[model samples]
Target: MKKQLHLLRQLVQQAVTHSDNTTSIVTDSFAVNQAGDLLMIKDVMIDYLQNLSFSKKPEVFIKRKILHTQRECITLLDMLPRTKMATPDQVALADQMRKCLDELLRHLHQHNCYFSCEVNAPYIEIQRITDKTFQKMTVMKAALKRKKIYSELLNIICAAFDRFHLSQQHTYQHLQYMSALQLSILKLCEKASDLDFDYQLIEHLTYWCFNECHFVDYCKSLIKKALKPHYGTKQCYEQLCHFEKRLTVQQEKANLRYSVQRNSVKYQLMVFVQAELECIEKKQQYHSGGKGVTLKHTAQIGSYRVQTSFSVAALAYFMKLLCESGIIQAEPRSQLLAFIAHHFQTPRIGEQELSASSLATKYKQVTPRTAHAMKAKLKELCQRIDDDFGSGD
Candidate 1:
């Protein structure tokens, strides 16, 4: 963890120096490169802190290290030269770095180590079940029929739901455990489906299940309700703050316990799922202008009329393919559909024009199997064209 932090510090130094060297008239590429550097540093620091929180070190030792690391990050950030005339992009980048540092400090100051032996016992038991279920998933992946695999996965998920219900205390650690189990179930589903399923879709479904079952939100509401009586009192404020600290500590301890089995398949699956989710979040932020950077959208071709006949489903599927392949980057599904509707003659049912909502619904319903088949067909066609045309050359 220290090594990772050291690497993060170096990245900060490099980024700061690069920004300091910027000319008065900054080129677009230079600004982008600088933003990328800061973003990389932020990601590295976050991963480092997560790893530290999950280490098997003593609580006192971990807390001390966190404080020190937080200070170091703040000091490095202070070195970033600030100017009154700084561009909005530069200001946004600096604000992002500062926000990351603030979160790190909050993690250090919060405490969450209030679990008694009786309370802790349930978590241990759940951990055991998680490990056992994960092992069963690994062993049965190749041998079990898809139906059996689905049954086993559903059983484990149901068991998690049951355990969550039986618990008297709805601590944050319990929610974390439930979340980890959900990710494991998603992995099992992906494996059973021979990786033909849309991971994002499965992730959305799993989270939706949690919401529909009222598991996560209920637990959070319970905690908040316990603190509700103290709303305006100073004593209440202090008590609530203390509780938050303890919650943070307890959550880290839970992470540490899970990290003991970090080499397990389930653990790797959790990591992969988290990384993919983060990637999706970053992409959304980039497209939505959350990074405080202004991007020019320029068209390479002049407007032209297009006469095409295709069902909404076909058009939606093609748009999805293009976005997933990086050929297009229209986000929010609606934006992409709107672009297509504007430029092409879209098919419509008798009275209604092709609606963005309808197209988005079809987009979600498009199966991965169909997408892959279409992609393969396109590749084969391209190969044939290349082969036939190469003879003339």
Candidate 2:
């Protein structure tokens, strides 16, 4: 046994040296460089011999197998991209390699130590022993048909796990078990399916392998934002700010354009009203200057309401315009004063029926000339408001 241990140490020391020296491990025909490296690597595999202990030798090989198998798997996966789109032959070759690995793993596990796998749900840990519980759970998932026999398999596997497991605090954790061996085995089966193997093996093997490895966390910490594809590139955030500024500038330009267009339309309407007013003035002068004879007329119909509605409706909107056009003067109380002068003077603008109380009292405060001046001003202001505003700004 001492001789075998010494031989194992020598093999490990040599293989580590060779791995350090070699640049590549494969050739066109087969592996020509790792031949010497492989021999040294194989010599260190102590679990392959039949006389090895279930207690001691299995643990040593477990550590070495973990390291060696990892290196070999990486080497093969790397070679895949170099091979032109995978052929059936290439897929077969990859499967053959993995199967060889599985056989080796089973052989090494033959002498592994045991612990009590017998227990109920919410598994009770026995002596902090083997990962038999995890393994059993993983395997039971794959074997739905023979659930009754699974309990016995669980106990046997647990006994082996107890002997192999090391303390969590121990510096050497080579035999330390994983928490989710089932998940790792599931992932492994997925990998095998990619190599064109039958899927049936994965479902069953995953159950058994669940007793072996741990499930690693594979989630990302951040949630990705859903943005335009351009946002994914560098410098896009700064460009987005610039685009926002340009949109604001365009909106301001549109508002200014609308205001200018509105003012031009008002100027045209005012010109038409002025021309019509000029024609009315010329016609009125012609009629008044020529009339010397009295003309017979009929009695007016509904004459009582004439001045009230006329003065307020026609003059209310136009009075303010006339005031602003220099046709009249603007002053406080000018609108009420204008109504008094016009109604009292010409066309007897309104009926005498309205108690002159409100108009008379207001007119008493101002002289006749002041009253006439204010009346003209009110009319001009009314005209200006009509031309400039829909409601007046």
Candidate 3:
């Protein structure tokens, strides 16, 4: 037993050393590395410990050492890049770790030392124990399926989040645990179609997804604001500031950029629009007239731009020109025009509606051509809306 403990300690040291020497970036062929070798040694130890059939009392000191080594190995395994463990060797070792974790939990459970509600253990810690234990009891899985564990973990996580309010201390580790719990619950769902999940877990997950979806929608709207045709430096700067604040808030909770892949389009769009806005701001402060910049209508759009200024209408017109020039697609052009028209509650600029000239005077300067195109697009969109959802007079 002492010899085995020595081997385990040596393996852990080797694994930790190899990991420290390696770069943080995980590549595809990591399984062939020395890190993989050390991990496999730990895997062998797990198997050896699991196979130990004792008729007599297990040595208390030896058991303590084994548990300590198991913990270090678990931590090291977690620190290893999950996505880089694609190779068979690395993958096998990972599976072995999970198996070992389950065995350890089982051992503790049989000895009545594993389950304690007093500690208020973090969800990740409980998850590590419960997930493996459930996996081990595959035959009695349905009966062993514990809703209390799921509910308890959720309560712990929610309490932590509420207490700290997502500041630096409460974020990274909490998010890591939340993400792992989400993945584990999802996997459990996939395994048993009839398995009932706790309502708290469901509600929490739903809220999380809804929050991310709202952020994505908000980003889309912000990009539209930034790209509006007559938008000037000041407006652009203000919009950028608003978007940055929201991004900071989201990042403080979780890495939404990584978790919500569908919102990547919005992220890319925001980045592009922000860069353009910064350029516009610099140009406005340096080269352009302040607060009263004016430009003549370069083109006519059914009297939409009697006089042009930089504003949302003008911005839409600018995007129309990009569309005409094949710089942007027709679908996005239509969408932007529609968005502006809906928000401003006007389809075209006229004597009755707000004049483009007045808007330009108040806001920033916009090219006449862009304003004209924007109004034209808006008019077309209004007519289409009338065709689709017109009231019967």
Candidate 4:
């Protein structure tokens, strides 16, 4: 009987949508559709409609019902502070049920399950004759996107983990707890990335925890038991703590990496700056007899000697800074400077009409030389780098 009745509602809806000029005679049809399954289908359709509506209003009654049911389950399991009545299985089952119910409630709240309002417009838009039509420019409206309550989310996740901790009392509950904590941390990072939160401490915390685990006490102890032998020895694992870093590593590592990168770029600038000076020297030699390579001087020799001189000088200075000072090791700094010099040490541009500033600007960086009057700017920069960072040597 219910199925037959359901068909009547669908049939009536189809007729109404197709109705055209039969407004009067079709009145009886509309009346039949309205009365057919009003009790059964009205709320069902409204429930589906709620999914499409986005509102900020909270549904207190529905939330209360879910909370009430969840609390009842928890109570039945005796998961209270004073009660040891809950068995391991009961605690786990109750916690899972509560989490599921709470998730549904959150979904409903996000959809703004119940809200209605009325607005009355008093004026009919009037079109005027013999008048100008004004065009309004486009405008932008700012809106706050719904933000996750991370603290609340974290608490719920911890609650679930507490149940996990209670249920098994396994050695690896510590490991699982760490997993839960890590997931919470990742969610925090995601929220910050999405502009829903502004947390600036993650980077600093990452450095503080560079070689340490975030979890301690019971959780860490549990994990220590779990990872006793089957995997990576506790020393090699370098987990990142930042919720916002585009690069990985402790904060100090990131800072040093940035410094090294800047220096490499500066060195490249120095290389090209030297090349410009060389071309100038060549032009002067061409104007005089010394500029052109004579029968005695080969172009290859001129190129190799000048390039090797600059390369050795730059590399030696860079290595000296790293080795002699406590700043860095000689090997790493030498390798880095060599890599940069290898990429940038191209033949000098012949005396084209382009000025040094224009060439540097075209490359999107300011040169230390043309932007200044110093004839030995490259040498000065290398010397400064050494003086500032150089140690005993």
Each prediction's TM-score versus the true structure: 0.25, 0.17, 0.26, 0.20
- Local lDDT at 226 for model 3: 48
Better of 2 and 3 by TM-score: 3
* lDDT of each residue in 1-393, candidate 1, tens digit only: 566567556545545655667654444454456556655655676666677678888877766766667557546545543422246765655555555555553454353232221222223234444555455654434343453434433444455555654654433344455556545555655554332232222343333333333333333343455445544433344434443443333312123222222232223333443453355456657777887332222354324435455567767787777887888754334545755665555545533446776666777688766577667767887889989886354
Q: Which residue pairs overlap in candidate 1's backbone?
A: 110-245, 111-245, 111-246, 112-245, 112-246, 112-247, 112-249, 112-250
Ranking by TM-score: 3, 1, 4, 2
Regions of candidate 2 where Cα sits further than 4 Å from its true position? 1-85, 114-393
lDDT of 2: 0.35
Local error of candidate 4 at residue 375 (angstroms): 28
Task: Report the Cα RMSD per candidate.
Answer: 28.1, 37.1, 19.8, 27.4
lDDT of 3 by residue, 1-393 (tens): 345445544433444444455543333354345344545554565565554433243667445554554455445434433323434654554454444444543443354332322223333354544454335334333322443334343444344333333332222233444445445455654553231234323333433442344334443554564446535545556555655554444322243322333544334445655676566666665676554332222234323433334355455456445666788654323233433443342334433444433433322345667666667867988889889999456
lDDT of 2 by residue, 3-102 (tens): 4334433433333333444432222223233233334433444344333433365666645544454344333323332333123433343333333333
Q: CA lDDT of 104 in candidate 2?
A: 35
Q: How many clashing residue pairs appear in each of the predictions shown?
A: 8, 36, 11, 2
358: Cα error in model 4, Å: 24
Please name the candidate that would achieve the greatest TM-score relative to the true structure: 3
Candidates' lDDT values, in order? 0.49, 0.35, 0.44, 0.33
TM-score, candidate 2, is 0.17
Best by lDDT: 1
Model with the higher TM-score, candidate 1 or 3: 3
